[model samples]
Target: MSYYDVDAILTDAEKVPCQFELDVPYLGHLDNSAGLKPGTALSLPLWLAEMLALASAGEDARAPLTLNLPACLSEAVAAALKADPRAVALRDQSAHLYGVGVRMLDLFDERELGAVLRRTWAVRAADVGLHARKADEAVGGQGAEFLRGLEEWERALFRRGHEGVRRAREWMDRVKRS
Candidate 1:
């Protein structure tokens, strides 16, 4: 098994290699040896780390600041979301991760907006690694419930327009008014 930390949490070893199979040959005969090693577990993908690193910063490019993602696992941000858009669709419709995604949109500047968040249905490519790591922590426990909520969360944000994105629009509107 392999492990890494993201969003201030340690993810399971299995998720390190993007993903793996858990199907048991028989009902309970699952094999564990097939899991990846720490060596193969990926470091945070560069673009994503930079995204997180950038959002975590203050007004200065290099200032260390503290903030939190409203929800850490938007299906769009999910590493495997592209792999399973249907499942992601469900989660987006029912989870609060949507609200988080909305908030995250606020943190973006013209740079990330042009680079991420506009492709694959408001999904960002740079976020895949961190989201993949988060999926490992969520397969069981509150993960399922959190996702359940995420389905609704995303729905609300999309229906109403993401908070951050809306703020961006409002800011632009104000500038136009001025």
Candidate 2:
């Protein structure tokens, strides 16, 4: 079975686009998007923005999007990462490590990174038993509950990131056979 089914788990999250004022022209087509003029602000999904930003940086070191995360979300991430320091500390930075996976998967379209993170997250989650739940609870039910409690935008971010990770894993499996 798959470790996560983002569509099933993230049904409650909305898709919020990130706004980017292009410093340089985006020459490629994005999801049938057209008329990408330089100096014009374009709104894109976070995953797309992240990928474009990285790709643009490589070509011109220009930032495609002016990204800003909310302060409360930052606090929530910090709190979640610090929730059980003793347990978290002994486990070798799993909290921050897990947070990184969540953040990267949420923001980017780097399949290799996602695949690596998928494996690392699985190993760490298993080591910590992070998903223990009653039979009545769905797999990752706790995470879903926690996600539901987040602010709308935060929930969206988490959902998007998880979907990225899932796609990455699927891509890896399809291409890695030798």
Candidate closest to the true structure, highest TM-score = 2
Off-target runs (Cα >4 Å) in candidate 1 are 1-64, 68-71, 74-77, 89-94, 109-150, 153-178
Give candidate 1's whole-model lDDT: 0.37
Candidate 2 Cα errors over 4 Å, as ranges:
1-43, 57-61, 69-73, 84-100, 103-178
For residue 38, what is the lDDT in candidate 2? 53
For model 1 the TM-score comes to 0.26
**Per-residue lDDT of 1-178 in model 1, one digit per residue for the tens?**
1234242132111111111122223322122344433222222322343343355234644412223332344334454444643344444332333333443455543333333333434542223323334554455875455435344424344334434555776899999999
- Can you give the TM-score per candidate against the true fold? 0.26, 0.32
Best by lDDT: 2
lDDT tens digits by residue: candidate 2, 82-132: 453222231232222334345545654546545544554344444223322
Question: What RMSD, rounded to one decimal, does every model reach?
Answer: 17.6, 13.7
**Candidate 1 displacement at residue 70 in angstroms:** 6.0
